[model samples]
Target: MSEKEQPRLASGLAQKVVDTIAPTIDRHVNIMNAHGIIIASSDAARIGTLHEGSVEAIRRNQIIRVAQADDTAGTQPGVNLPLILNERLCGAVGVTGAPHEVEPLADLIALTVQLLFTQEREHSRSARRAAEARDIISALLAGHVAADVIERTLDAHGLRAPLQLELWLPRSEQDPLLEQPALDGARTCWVGLFGAHWRLRKASDEPAADAPNANDRYLIGPAAEDAGELLAQAEAMRTLAGRPAMLPRRELEGIWNQDIAVAVARTPARSLKYLAARAQVLNQEQARTLLVVAAASSMSEAAESLHIHRNTLVQRLERIGQVTGADIRQAAESLRLQHAVYARIALDELQVF
Candidate 1:
């Protein structure tokens, strides 16, 4: 950790400790930082002031006792005990009474301060590790880092892979279930909030034993060497979520490659933005009719699916061609129109508007 980022016993916590300790011990108590500046004290005037006896206690890593007769600048008649956390001097605690009388109370308060500091440091370290883990996952999925680099980075964070990635989108932003850990039995798992969704990656030999509940949508990507492919599968899953024909319990694995319609849907919005814009010329009914025609086996089947006469379907198709400047009768033109429909769906799912 950087020097500036190193955790310290916060002043508020120090004050609370002083308040707790003061009731039991008749002596006034003060908490001082490493620099000997008083952070919290039972005597309010002492706060923000330097305590010379506490400075000496920290510098010597031992107790310093001052007498009233030997008063010096910033010195008080009390016992100062250095607060040590993990073998390092973090601060000091001072008790305002005769040296022999308050020495034990000062020692007890110092121990409490050390314990609190250790706990705070551990919590800080855990938070920093979680943030680093999320950054690595995001970079890998975005294809900004190569596999070799990711391997090294993960190792540096003490994370190993053979990892599984799961994408989840909760129905509500404040869902409490999102607080649950991703995989209970994995060696180590990292869950992060990515905009409107959550991304979970775990290092495990096999899949998670349990799945998330129905209140949230999830797509579990297969274990693979390339994370970019998993990202593409997530994109395809999002596109499918917006489709009317998508089943509630559909398996999303391999949908990007095994299904031609989904494969076309996976096309990046930037690549099909022009066609999506041109598609805007048609109304919602015309667009729906076009998608039905492209999906159905025959013109009559398409009309029946849309609950319209074949002639009406024919006229709508002709009008769609005129608006988008594409002949829906030709095979290639029909495929392009289908791709445009998927692109629109993908863009909408992405919230590109």
Candidate 2:
């Protein structure tokens, strides 16, 4: 690993390594710091003393074997190997036994130590990046972070621009997506919790956006181009929850129109409630008639779609007006009346105005 990313081989970590491998082998194990002093040993009495074989192995950056006749003070006849990670020498490990018998065990122990160190480094890096991503997302939503600042931060973290964000509400607490690992440089997307909802941000070109499936667990918001747009979409989705009539149908998508109808999506809840209340008094037949009339080019065309006689459709419209307190025939009131109908279909009656 690079110097900045290298993990320290503290006494605790050294002791852990000795404890793990010593049990699997009959030989005594010793983990030494880069300075050649034993930091951890299966034989605790040898701690803090220099191992001659370990010093030689570290100096040469290779395995060194001390024979029975050649063994010196503060050392035993054993095999020692240098611990190298990402081309950098970190420390050494020594196994006490005949040189030939302990060489293989020493090699295995060295590899294990390097793997543990590598894992620790990666875990640290992932945590640091996650914190950075949360901060960037929070600042962007708050409007405190500039576009240039976002661009620079993303570049530094290996994330690209021209990103699209999706908002999703989990249908249950056991969602599998919640278990996904944190974002890293290798990933093109990141999932995070923002406020009371979850936001998934990914590269715009990663995949095509599809209409939400009726059986899906999440109620997804439209892909937003920026944090401001995302906020508005989130608001609309939350307000429309538990009222399926306001959402898009599987065969005919209507909710997607919010992309162009930004004003409707951003409508204040009080105004929406008032508009919705106008249609709340209508029965199912009257509500359906009003929706058809609002979408139809002419009253006759609406009658044709509903499979009802033209005169019958007119009578239904009159009844709808009487109950809704708004006339659908007036051009000026039609738009507001239609919005009111949509608001009515999308919001729950139990919700306070």
Candidate 3:
């Protein structure tokens, strides 16, 4: 709708707005839907009639409107103008004058529509984001869910992963950086555990805010390879917990043995947690402790599997005993620690199962 149709329109407003804007340009204004149904027009005949074929600009919400020099845009030499609200496209305005006349009007119309749509779109989008954010938190915080299922749920909501994951822990939600040009280059996701957030993209696309509290790992990949790769990454994510951090294709490959990859596929629910927590743990020492707990109910065998010399393993065992108050020398204690680490594969959430 035009500004003239606003709820609190001024007296003599419709005619006045038409008079003021029409003279400022040389083309007639036409407002149409995607189906070419003309809702309103400055030209009398076009008011109730359709534009013959589809009105593509309306469908795309694009500002610039065009037609061939001879196409049915009425007597215009060629249609060139814009349908806009305040520097944004809201509706189309066509100019019959030369390029000089048409060009400026196109820009002005785009500008006008942009302004008109800005507040409305933003308000609507904000409410939508708030609602979706609640849902995202629900996904992360509530219930027992399989890894593939959570991944699929995210996909259903348009979040796909193995997204080039990165953690962003912001000091404040009110940061000005959120609206900067740089933020326009990625998608965001949040994790409250580490106070982290992430930015994702397939290739390079405009950065969008995270769907909500579901942050920390952003998926950036080539668009076409996204789904399958995300699944593989999810499996990797499951297996890599407690390992030293390595970017993909680093020393990390050999570290992820075939068995670990298999373990990842089999352990869906724990996978996301494990990988995320693994990244957070960040050092071989901590990881080794977790792995030692994982390998055996006996510290002696855990040490053997880890290939550490027995005395050194004893010292390491002592360190873990000091930290967890559980003697790895005891099978029950060792087993409990192992289960805790393994169960916490995706540590960002509370996993009872």
- Among these predicted structures, which one has the highest TM-score? 2
Per-residue alpha-carbon lDDT of candidate 3 for residues 1-353, written as tens digits (9 for 90 to 100): 23464222121322233445666665665444334555545565765566532255455554343334544544444243325443333344444455554667656653554454565555655555445534543444333445566566556556554345333333367755444222222333333322333333334354434322322222222343444444454334333422212112222222223344334335556454644442342234655455644546666776666778778877776767776676756767655555444334334232211
Candidate 2 segments whose C-alpha is farther than 4 A from its true place: 1-10, 44-49, 69-72, 182-202, 205-254, 259-271, 281-338, 350-353
Tell me the deviation in Å of residue 144 in model 2.
Answer: 3.3
Indicate the residue-level lDDT of 325 in model 3.
71
Candidate 3 residue 72 Cα shift, in angstroms, is 17
Ranking by TM-score: 2, 1, 3
Candidate 2 residues 1-353, lDDT tens each? 35665546878777888898899897899998887999999989989988777788889988888887443365578888898875678689899888889989988988888788778777766667567766655555555556666666756766553345444444444666544454544332234444223344554444434423444323445445554554444455544433433444433332234432344445676777765666678766675676667667788998987899999998988887787667678866666665665676555442111
User: Which candidate number has the best lDDT?
Assistant: 1
The runs of at least 3 residues in candidate 3 whose Cα sits more than 4 Å from the true structure, single-residue gaps closed, are: 1-23, 26-28, 33-36, 40-48, 51-92, 95-134, 156-170, 178-187, 190-353
Tens digit of per-residue lDDT, candidate 1, span 1-353: 45555346689889988998898887889999989999999989889999888888989989988878354464568898988756667789999878898898988998887777777766776666556756766665555566667667756665454455565555565666555432222422335444434344554555455555543445565664544454455455545444423212223321122254465455554675775665667666776777667667788988887789999988898899999998888888867766666566555532111
TM-score of each prediction: 0.54, 0.69, 0.32
What C-alpha lDDT values do all the predictions have?
0.65, 0.64, 0.44
What is the C-alpha local distance difference test score of candidate 2?
0.64
Residue-level error in angstroms, candidate 2, position 289: 9.7
Alpha-carbon error at 316 in model 1, in Å?
Answer: 36
